[model samples]
Target: MASRARHGGQAIDGRDLKGKAVISGLGLTEMGRIYGHSGGWFAAEAIRLAIDDAGLEKTDIDGLLVNQGMTPLPGMGGVDLQNQLGLTNLRLLSSMNVGGATAGIMVQYAALAVSHGMANHVLCVFADAPLREGRGGGAAYGGGGQQPQPRGMRGLYTAFGMFGVNARYAMAASRHMGMYGTTNDHFGAIAVAQRGWAAMNPLAQQREAMTLEDYHASRWVAEPLHLFDCCLVSNGGVAVIVSSAEGARDRKQPPVYIWGMGQGHPGDLNRAGWDIETQTGAPLSKERAFSMAGIEIDDIDVCQLYDCYTYTVLVTLEDYGFCAKGEGGPFVADGKLGPGGSLPTNTGGGQLSGYYMWGMTPLAEGVIQARGQGGDRQASKHDVVLVSGNGGILDHHCTLVLSPHPA
Candidate 1:
């Protein structure tokens, strides 16, 4: 789909950091509904697995970065990870939050650190314990809504903020429909296609094949956003090991090179004419990242765009120039993102069908695909992979261009 306006895969002259670093190891704990542990436990265990996967011991890691997600609890997978893992003398250590974008940003930070001599090996991790034993997935995200009721007419200004993310995304999706004649079917196409991808994934939570009828029959979470529009809640962790390209050579696992990285932060969502419904931070992040990768949109063989909701995939495709604006509805409805499609996107089912680890959901799948380890769902073309993360109410965005070959 992006082949229409494609550029040759040539490195553009700029501050290039292509192939400077690589992800040497990846560790994922059992995901989805396997309760009885804290987020900290998951993070620590993932780090251990990642270190072992890289053929390195705990002492080899000198940097630690954590993404605890938005509104994290008192001990949500960070703050105590280093001490719990018994990792000490860390040259780089920090806890950051860009909402769902944190996982990508953490890798960027780790890559920079390892390349610049701040640290030799860096660990990036994200985890969550949102699923309680007795409660449903909705309970983790406020089944009744996260805000308190308004008492007076003066409280009307807080109307939009009173609900949780379901309402917020519904507004964004509704705006697309009003402006571009988009339909529920367009969003349903995304859900159905990703579910199809999930059916081939062993770690996927919802592997059952779904059809257009099933998507339409699902209950509505908010207006046009259906039950399948939202991501799944999981109790697990994902960790990655970032090392210099030279350091990654001959590692235990195939090295997944970090060819390019970029981050974009929209100043204010309420600004006049802010493109909240029509655009996203992907466009702003794309140029810097692609140039560093020495490639264009056509060179990308696979994509792992964040899919906290079905609308997220549609808008991100439009913003990343994969398809024309307002045509995202039709672009997906044509069945272009599923298996055997022109563009193999979200090959691991994404957050929709994959276990939700915030940005790590897409990032982990990118690593797997780049290493040619996706097994049954692996894309035929594996030269270049595109990964993106969107945070806030589309306020922050980050992109990483990864490849099995060096840049």
Candidate 2:
């Protein structure tokens, strides 16, 4: 298959993009709320488990990547975490504030660190509690956690409303729905397929089987988006270990090679309708990513694109060249993404069912899928998997291509 050209414009100018990194370990907490532990506790637990999975001690991990601003529980910030975890001597530590894309960004950063010899082992962790502690009541929307409501326009209050703004624009942009050959059913199919996969995994929340009828009858969230279309505000932490491919010799689990990774920041704000291909300033993060991986679309055995909303996944499919422009709806509807199909996606149920650890859960899914760690029900003999994340209303895109251990 021909390599998908870079977003068709603007040559990339950055560090060399040819070296390979490897994932040596993976760790994650349960999806639902664990009442006693705080956010920091989740982070610490994830890190500890990830290190143990790698068959290494805490001293083996020198780099730390996490997101802190979420769930204002005690010890949230990166430095606070370092102090809390007693890792004050650590070398590289940074927090990814890109929201949903935090996990993907953390992966990219850790890979870069390993490739450059900045660190021998990088531990990436993601954790948070649901808005309402599974009592079905908390700050389900505005940011996260059980915080008081903001009557007037304020800080996090404004950030909470930002998604509503994105939804409004998405609804307005629906005028092109007919142009794209998309429909509510297309979105429903994506949701149902994910829910099906979630049922197989013991970790997913909404394991119950869903039908098209159930989807259509579901309550509305932002119009065009049913209640099931959006992810739940559940709590959990997920982590992964990264190391140089050459150094994975003694690892307990098979190492999944990091083939290629890239992130994009479209210059447009939430309201703009800029055509990504034609616009000079619109960053083609996905294009650069595919180029770095040196692979074609058909080479990807499975994919996990961020699905904060249906449109997020749709626009990403088009932007990333998964299909021609405006073809995501039909591309996903062809029934090739479910079991025994061309590409089984979200085998872990995704944020929709598995757990809402941002898109971190999807990143873990990609890692496990590439490593052949997925159990019999969702596992297939696939080598390469594409994990993509969307943050802040499609403003930032992160793509990582992973391959099973080399022969």
Candidate 3:
């Protein structure tokens, strides 16, 4: 039970923090390999958009949290960003990264800050532009895939067993397949389904129609992991504004209350009792998040799970109690994650077909779904939304229970 003793930190840590803070605004930019413009530009533009979305001026922002990605924008997390935004005398300022899990963690910390009166409105933003001219995704990430042979220290490290994300996640998919009879078809189903949702999103990078056949036809990124099975390598930014529930209620956009949140860290892959293929931190995180939100699994209307890969989605679904340990393949292959399915997941195409802003991909879509602004990708029931973020080969996890109705 010590693992499940979740607490929202800050000055006021005794009372339940559910419904104490809300995400009042979201800002996004054209993502996925957009040329030019550094991450700082995208971040600044996103913050401005978020401020305007919340009907707040630049000076109204008292706090800022920046989530750094593979390619950190200059002056992103320090006073330089503050100066760029013309925000003076900030009460909160910090830069953080827990790989992809930072988005939900950022919101959780922001909620605590505002709920404890540390800052009235906190801005959380993440942006990355890794692709250089003529280089493919592999070059951006540094691997043998689709790029020239590694050079210098990178080649030495690669020789020393340092691998890219594709290899690591591909190994996870292979392990799951070996243990649970999960197959390429199951992963393909996720890819095709999210692609269907992407067709409806204006900001989605890959909105083309896709079929199961298309998924199978895609080239392999790491066997068992196709190009489609992996998430898109994107260049973009996403920003969210967290405000006190009282302050959010009067904002321009509808408030998506932060009912409950929890985080889990299972430690390094070498750690005992930690298995990347069969287990993750989701078990403990889900217990605390659902308990804090005062809701059961069935109460969830939609899921915005971090989709770093299709396999990641399937494994996470099983860990979050959506299906039994080994049944995620069939659970997702049933066409349930696509639009109009019983369980709509990754409605904005997710990172598979949509732009990848790390955890902000799910967090942004969760906010949109909670606000009923998902357009054709919006689910019918948006009362309760579950958002999940996975970091560092699923070693770190963050779960957030959000809803349109205050708890």
Candidate 4:
């Protein structure tokens, strides 16, 4: 039998680390398509901004964690960032690639480091510049490397023209519709609602007001997935500072306490004997996070769900227990995810309508909401926030619960 903690079972409650660490600072670069900037430049800029925001200097940072999305080029990993920033003293240094789940897992590691006295102040940074005009852009999936295909898998996928991440997610959405009576309009509602939130964020790339009609008229990238349903590819970086709860209390901003965290990885979708349409790793991750936090889903006043696609958000809503299984379509059809809705989600517009920094955008938004800094899109009750990250074709899942007060 599998170990209890392996499947996010009840064995690991995370009580020992609850409220031991907090996010003291959050910083982001101007998010948009930049023609002449490298990923390291953006990462450095974000790190400096975060250190300044935390009211600390580089000398105070003894730990670093870097998440570089889909770019395996040399001198872009954690050690490269340390050298770029010229930090001499370091205790913990690491790099992570969990697809979109990188940022959430970064925080989990940061908390562990601080709680264990392995590091004093940890800087978690993420940067990506995948889209460049004219020249063929770098690969956006699988870290710019080719994966080994099984005997017949390549031929089968090629026959159906099912290449890349979009087609795989499209298949998942199609299966969801067949089983749950979900409609394209249901997915459209998510795009429209997040775009509405994006319209309020000055840093958002797609801030233009989009109506349901506009969403329906948008070009289809794949069956049941429109242009607006997809995430925007832009150049940006984000940095967050994690410190002990006692140290965070003296920082410049209100501390966003780390209450609980959990991670799970369902088998890869590319492999055989995996059902991409009916199953995701989110439920197990959610169970462990909520169990560790000693709170239920209703306690979350705000949510920053990874929005790589509109269907990603809908399936997460169902998997995270915000609504009944297979009832995500009807649950979000009433503008419940928009501003002033009963469940305010993706207040920063998410990757779909906001800038896409992979999972970092959602983590930054969660900290802002917990600190009560979300200007117009702030949730009415910003006490507890639920943040989720999805990697690959729903293969990896990470969940975090943030609160304004310690547990």
Cα lDDT, all candidates: 0.85, 0.71, 0.87, 0.85
The TM-score of predicted model 3 comes to 0.92
Best by lDDT: 3
Model 4 C-alpha lDDT per residue in residues 244-279, reported as the tens digit of each score: 998777678888999989887877645667665656
| Candidate 2: residue 163 Cα off by (Å) | 6.8
lDDT of 1 by residue, 235-291 (tens): 899999999999888879889999989887766657777766567778778877877
lDDT (tens digit, per residue) of candidate 2 on 87-197: 755668877688777788888888888888898888888878644544552254533222356444444544555345336435633643746657888888788888878
Candidate 2 residue 3 C-alpha distance from true site, Å? 14
Q: RMSD to the native, candidate 1?
A: 4.2
lDDT of 1 at 219: 96
- Candidate 1: worst 10 consecutive residues by lDDT? 1-10
Extract clashing residue pairs from model 1.
none
